[model samples]
Target: MEMSEIQAARLLLGGDGRAGQAASRQVGQESASVRYGEVKSVDAEAGTMTVLLDGQSQEITLTDSTASTRLKAGDRVKIVKQGQSWVIDLAGGISRALDTAVSEANARMGAHDETMAQQQAAIEAAQAELAGMDRKISDAVDTAISQLETPDGGNHIYAGADEPTPPKDGLKAGDLWYQTNASGQIAAVKVWNGTVWNGYDMVANSILVAGSVGSTLIADGAVTTAKITAKAITADQIAANTITGAEIRADSVDVNEIASGDIYCKRLTATDGAGYTEMTGNKLEMLDSGSRSLVAIWVEGGVCYINANLAEKISIGTNSGSVLNISNGGFIFSSMMPGFRVNGVSAVESFAIAPGSATESFSANVPYSPHKTSYAVVYYRCTYTDTAGSVKFPITEGGSANVVLKELTAFEAADESIALGCAENITVALGNSPNKTFAITRGNPYRFAIKPSGNSVNANPGSQFEITQVTLCGQ
Candidate 1:
């Protein structure tokens, strides 16, 4: 049967339900009885309950008590019969006492969770520190490897036909023993002995220049004749002033090898037809095709001779436009060309001409000197106007008799130098003369004649004229 609050409270409070009280229970079969059973149903109004006892349902009355505890179906209890009163031992009554222990266990579990979170954060920080250490170690290893690379940053074998420029300042121990050229052949091995490269130098003269290939470095006389090829050493490969007369071996210089450039030796003999040059006992000669001397310098005469065609002109001085030019003019100057005056003055004041068919003339002596020049110039100032032709000079001069003139057709015009029309204060120059040259003397007179035009009429002693500055100018 279901236990009531009064019975449960009594069982829990040990009200006639303890083993001590069981001593007071009657031991006889009909005196008192006790049984263990599960309640199947309860009826609160009837104060009765149905319980399973020994696998059978039994109806039992619930006893009331001052305790307020209650029980329902499914309650496990031990029922005790003492005369007419009943006592119950309830299982629910024991479970109520364990609540405090369960609460304490829950609080401990929460504290453990908080400790785990703190440990996790600390582990992450340790991992970050380890990563930074890894980077530092990696940097240290890289620096060590770089130091192990070379004395300089790079001291490997050099390449290319040109030379190499090794670093000047670097670690001092390791030296560059040799370097290769652009042809991939190892040239003269230069050993850099911590301080300098051992070799022959020209500019510095103590150590090798950066142009370190194709030169000797071991010592003097180290290079044998077998190392040299025929005509291998040209002029450009030798440094200036380094190869002197004392070091030169006899007949070592092949004249054919000097294709161009001047060679200043005491004597040089070249082969025939090879831009020939030879120094003999008396003269130094330069040849053209082979035997013909283009130029020669003779020690006996102390004169430099030029043998060429007459068309060649000798030029002197080096300036832009101003220079002494010696050309083959038809009128050659012997010593000097002094000036000559027509009438001992620069001008002839008055000149007169006669009437038609009769000509007035002027004449002067040559003074037995060079009285004519290469140029012909004439000028006149007019004081008269007449139909007479201009005063004219003979085209050919200088003879005791009639002057020898070439064919008349050689001159197509009366005078190409002067204009036909006359004007006051006019001047004319025959600077562009013909190629023919002439001599001048008193034998042939100037005449200075003027003839009137054909079919023209004129007055007597007509139109007296003025001739000013009739000079044969020098070219």
Candidate 2:
């Protein structure tokens, strides 16, 4: 038979069968020291191999005794040193070692996963505890804010240094207490009537006993006029003669309150006997010892009489109206005097005269006694044409334009010739006419005449000369 390659390699090494076998056994033992590497190169015919050991390339001779001849580049293999030569083999042993390493790595990964889960659970627990703490803190803050006495909470009433404590409970209707009012000031005693507290002033409610002399309840000057009701005090309440002249206000007493016959005197005459004597009657009279009444006041009738001549003149009415003026020498009634009645019949004659033509003359007969002094006032209006003409109008009492009379002589003589008075003349311009009035006093039968100035007295046609209204007043 042909000798195997291993036997031929042993003969060349000069080894007999037994010695070769023994040497082979020793090589195999040495080759059992295995390490993992990668095959870098392989040459099957040369029986040479290059393997990477410890990150370095190493040459290996593949003898016939080598186990695998199918090694190729990039193949994981097991390398062993055998008697000054390296041997390359299939990576069976390496594969077994890798399986063990894989098992250890998987165990470590499982442990890491367990640790991460535990850490996550701890984080979640910490978050939950933090949230609970936050809620507790918020509740505590809310409780503190609610207890404050600000505008958002309780208003107006808060205990201060000088203020009273606010009532908290046990409230009843009309129960009295104290608190701050709406004005933020300490109020007077306030009453509670189920719903709200009502404030009241204490001083205004207190009452004082009448006739109590020395009571300290009311302060000095505290009682004013506003506090007293109308007619609160009567005469019975006031002490006798307690009010003085200084205490009584001016004009406090009315005239109606005084009793009649309160004023009296012993005599009207002075001690020097220069005044008149007082006389007793229904009238208040002052007289001389000769029993002649000098002055008298009729108290019941409200009339006054003077027997003696008065030093000053008396004026009865104002200047604008009828005036009955009495002087030392005489008395006169002015224009517009209302006539006196005789036996309830109208004694005075009044005329509402219409305007006459300027060319005509007008006349009126007045009831006048020739022996008695009488007065007449004439009011006339004259209208003229637009021409340069002058007109003189004369007011005649009798037929003549001029009549003379002495007033004192007329009254003394009582003769008609002495009583008849003169006529007065008033001139008017035709260009600018105006109203005129005049007053005359006479004691005669009178006929008033209005005539033009010239003998051939003719007014301009359609021109008006009139006595609109005439009042004849006498006393």
Candidate 3:
């Protein structure tokens, strides 16, 4: 993340500001700079952590216990100046692009494994149905072979000459030439050799019918994929759950073989999309590589939660386009930013002075609306210590970045008409405008200051004019 982009960054680097001049470190104060990094490793015993900053690894000590508790490897942290020394803290709002990329790769591999399992199950079912058909074909082949005769080099169909006609439905008499058994029976009469026989014999003009195709006729391992017609076996031929995991070969099925359908998986990833979708805790979530929600939908107890995530802003509208857009810049509706009059004023900035001492003269950040609302009132309460004078606040731009500035903005609160008197236990509400609402920008924090309105500070540096509370009102 860029240092300049960090909202929490307090910098004193010698970079040219919006103004021509850059701020320099003043005497007797430590200069500081803010930078971001990823934690590589943490050693609580050693009081240090190895961090990757700007593509380089560097070791930094953990001086703050709070920061140490929040840090771990793969987490990002920022090195910032705190008081007199540099300290490490978790970096808020910094981009974690590297970690997100790694997550996406892992998700893709998981999806691949799940897809392979489903394909294997489907292919195995087809193999079982193929085996069943092999039994039926074998029996038909054997019946023809037994009736073969000489003069045919290989088996061929029999001719009508001296050949018995085939049966219509079942085996019958007169379909073949029969010789008398050892018992010496008459022509076309029943006869038996040794085995027990049923009382039946061949009759005239009757035909022999083929018997059931027996499993014993077919040799094991005779049928294979080469013997079957392509696409002949379908789902109807294969029984459900007939194929088990043991019947499948490793990596036998691939994506090319699978037809388009719904894929159910624990984790599904697509590299082209750079994200993953998964089910967790009964909620289905689709997330980007960064783990930020891209889109999600789930139902529980008749209630559904649908989520779509966008950075910094969200818009809602019809098919035409967006009618309402909510962002850090504030709500913009149909090409217009919402406007409220001064009567709708609210506190935009507020801070308390020390119990007895006033806050030091420094450039602290103040909230400003992107729509450029105007501030109108300066309010404060001070208990007087026999002191009588007014302290008007004059806010300005281009304040120094130092923790303490030796000079102040040219405008004094006195230069403006508004006056805040130093009276005991009294509250003051002075109308401050024209100067209070200075140069502004959208969606950014501006720098405001508290300093002497003249000799009010250098002469009376005690609780005589100490502010109990102060608030900046904007509309």
Largest TM-score belongs to which candidate?
2
Tens-digit per-residue lDDT, 140-173, candidate 3: 6545643543354422222222223443443333
Q: In terms of TM-score, which candidate is stronger, 1 or 3?
A: 3
State the displacement of the C-alpha of residue 266, model 2, in Å, after optimal TM-score superposition. Answer: 99
Model 1, 55-113: lDDT tens digits are 33334445533111466787665666655566654543334324545778888988988
Instruction: Tell me, by lDDT, which candidate is best.
Output: 2
lDDT of 2 by residue, 1-475 (tens): 4344454334323233234363653333332355565666776776656544443332333453343466567767765556744455455745765887899999999999999999999999999999999999967754453233435432323222233334475444544444545663555656555677676445644456565543524555444222333744554234332333333443234333434454455665544565666657866666665656666655555655544433355556875565665554344344333323433333233222332432234443434423211233344333321112111122323322232311111222333232211222432111111222222322222222222321222322222433334343323
lDDT of 1: 0.41
Candidates' lDDT values, in order? 0.41, 0.44, 0.42
Q: Which candidate would rank higher by lDDT, 1 or 2?
A: 2
How does candidate 3 fare on TM-score?
Answer: 0.21
Residue 349 displacement (Å), model 1: 36
Clashes of 1: 2
